[model samples]
Target: MLATMPAAPSDINVLILDDNQFDRVRIRRMFESLEFGFHLSEVENLDGLDQNLDNKDFDIVLIDYNLPQGDGLEALERIQKHERNCNATTVMIAGDDQSQIAVRALKSGCQDYIAKGTLSTHRLRSLVLSVIDAAQASPTNTDDLHERLELLVSRVKEHHSSALQPKVAMIIQDIRSLRARVYQPHSPLAVELAAVEKRCLNLWSSLSETDAITLKAPKDVRVS
Candidate 1:
């Protein structure tokens, strides 16, 4: 009997960074043939990668180990630093037989490494699925905090829209007062805001840790 296969989920966005046209074409074809879903975009080099990243959000990044200016490792480091909530698992692809490079990539936060010559459609599908699973399993607290802040801002805007003339005048006055107070270096309100921001970040970190632990427990139980 044929082995059962898992159902394909909705298409996840993927960014492929490779300078070689042949490799990019081949990788795209392989992904197209897979049962796994993917909305793919290709970049020829680091510049292209940067532009694509600025405009789009990808679920996974497949970076070539060798590039024109700098290698994949450098690109990975830059991406991690610049992209907020960049939890996308990076996979380093190489044609060379350099085990050390693979190890280094893994150390630098790559989810997996695949030799270019050995890449197959099935293996690619499996790797993508694993990365997506890991991302879903690990939720970042910074993202949650940013989301809450956005919601608060939206509510404030809504209140501003529905306010009467007197309320609007009062709100405008309050804003001007707050701005003036913030300009003073020794202002108590500024100190208070700083403390609140720090506390919120700490709370976010604590919540992230707690959520990670909660997620891992169930996985551990299933594995055991």
Candidate 2:
């Protein structure tokens, strides 16, 4: 039996931070053309960004890599500091050749990054829909993380002898790094990511003791 695809959101509230008027117009036009309804509010500087960020319950925030009054990364950090807005999916917009900046933004916790030169209605629609779906599916409370962790740990135990274990190990390491790199240490998302990191570490430690998968545990920490 085929699984059903989730329905598109009927309405989406979007916050955009970009000082360039032309880019704002382009983004507006692209968003307006989408079949699903979206309400976009543009912020050209830090003051506007700070004001609307607190007042609006946005589903997504599109941040530009370049800003006149302050750095875009700084703006992103400010957004993370707001606990009420933590659920919003952030996407960074960068110049076509600004790959380094884009990588930094992604590592800093933006859900995704898009090149300004490649902006189009089709691409924008796809990215917005995907982010919205992920945001909608994400856990709204801490308890959900435990349920998810248990499921992941079960998967690890089941695949203990398979080649897929190594790939899963790599994913665990990435989650650990993500948890460490998060800006809002006390935010629900950060706490959840930390829980995942701890569980994966525990799984790897147990596997190491049993000599499973030829995977060597990190040497610095003693496995419990």
Highest TM-score model number: 2
Error of 2 at 203 (Å): 18
Model 1 lDDT tens row, 1-224: 22333554446788999989999999999887775567899988888888887887777889998999899998898678656426666889987687888999999898789987789887787876676566556645888978988788666544543333233334434544554568775688766655554554443333333322222212211111
RMSD to native for every prediction? 16.9, 15.6
TM-score result, candidate 2: 0.59
Tens-place lDDT per residue, model 2, 29-74, is 8887775678899999989988998898888898998888777798
Q: Write down the worst ten-residue block by lDDT for model 2.
A: 1-10
- What is the TM-score of candidate 1? 0.57
Query: Over the full model, what C-alpha lDDT does candidate 1 score relative to the true structure?
Result: 0.70
- Please count the clashing residue pairs in each candidate, in the order shown: 0, 0
Error of 1 at 75 (Å): 0.9
